[model samples]
Target: MQGAWFAFILTLLAGLSTGIGSLIAFFARRTNKTLLAVSLGFSAGVMIYISLVDMLAEARLDLLGQYGQPGEWLALGAFFAGIGLTALVDLLVPEVENPHHAWRVEEMESAAEAARARKLLRTGMVTAMVLALHNFPEGIATFVAGLMEPATGVAIAMAIAIHNIPEGISVSVPIFYATGSRRKALLYSCLSGLCEPLGAAAGYVFLLRFVSPGIFGVVFAMVAGTMIFIAFDELLPAAHEHGEHHHAIGGLIGGMAVMAVGLALVR
Candidate 1:
């Protein structure tokens, strides 16, 4: 029960970071692209390390116990299925309006807003909706993984929180520009984040009842795959794009090293 509550709080905090990003976008005079880049890179490293070393390792072991000979293939299949699920969601959103793009402060300040108000409004609303949907499965994956293992859950939670900050900016920048209401923009950003905890709560309530060793193993494997995809497909690229040559790489190594220590201490 305590662990469950802890997990929920972790997810909640991660979701709310959208608001933090919104706040940064609205209030901060200067954009710290380099810091954001390093953080994203670090998050990717943490997620990748935990997915492969901890989550997937445990998943494969449980799967093997569940189906001694066939477990390997099943685990592998589930992993890919997770990736496919996330990719499908990505495909559904139009490339021009993908909500995941990190918006820069300079760009926001310099844009010709009066001319583009109508377009920005449409883009903002669509992006918010798409981001909300995208976060649902992530919420489920995070909640379940945490319940399965608290240490790994903490790692995942931290990584997700870091990853979502730019997303918050993505959702808020256009909306604020379109509506000219800081309050409204902040509200939308927060609401989008709320979907994560809501999804987590629903996932836990509905799925916990039916969980078995095999089910747990498969879900964990899927979560691992999803994390890996997010790391490579989203986090790393964004990080590198905004980063100085070595900053993102340095952050990545630091994140992995920190996770290694945590894994060692936990074991």
Candidate 2:
């Protein structure tokens, strides 16, 4: 019960970190492009390294123990299935309104044009909806990982939280500018973030009766696939868009190194 509670709390905290981004959007004078770039890159690195080194490996081991050599194929299939699911979600959302499309805090300055306000509001609402969809799988990933290993859960939650900061900015900026209401912007941002915990709760309810080694193996592999897709497709590109290539690369390497050290110590 304690472990379950811990995992739920971690998921809740990760989801709510979007509110931090909302607050930053309101207070920061300018988008710190370089910092954003590096941070996003760092998050990508952490996710990629952990997904491959830890989650995938663990999943393979679990599956192999259960099904012998055929388990290798199963693990691979589950991993790709995770990617396919995320890709399907992406295809459903129009590219223009995809929350993964990075938004800068500086956009707030120009968003006051009355002609564009309605469009911006629609964009914000769409982005929020899209982000909620993206966060659902993440909530499942985080919750399952936390249930399996608290340390890994903490790392995954932190990575997801870091990336979500920008998502909060993405949803809030356009809405705040469109509605001229901080409260509305914050409310929408919080609502979008709430999906993470909602997802966790939903996954828990559905999977509780069937929890088993095979289930863990499948979920871990899927989680690895999902995180890898996010890192490569979203985080890396967004980081490059900030125009700090070297810094982004440095942050990536730094993030991997930090995760490596942390894992070594924990093990």
Give the number of the best model, judged by TM-score: 2
What is the C-alpha lDDT profile of model 1 across 34-106, one tens digit per residue?
8978898899889889988888888899999999979999989999898888888778878777766645765
Q: How high is each candidate's TM-score?
A: 0.94, 0.95
Q: What is the RMSD, in Å, between candidate 1 and the native fold over all Cα?
A: 1.6
**Model 1: residues with Cα > 4 Å off, grouped in runs:** 112-114
Pairs clashing in candidate 1?
none
- Candidate 2 at residue 184, lDDT? 96
Q: Write the per-residue lDDT of candidate 2 for residues 66-144, one digit (tens) a residue.
A: 9999899999999999888877876887887787776688764565454488888988888899899888888887888
Query: Candidate 1: minimum summed lDDT over ten consecutive residues — where?
Result: 106-115
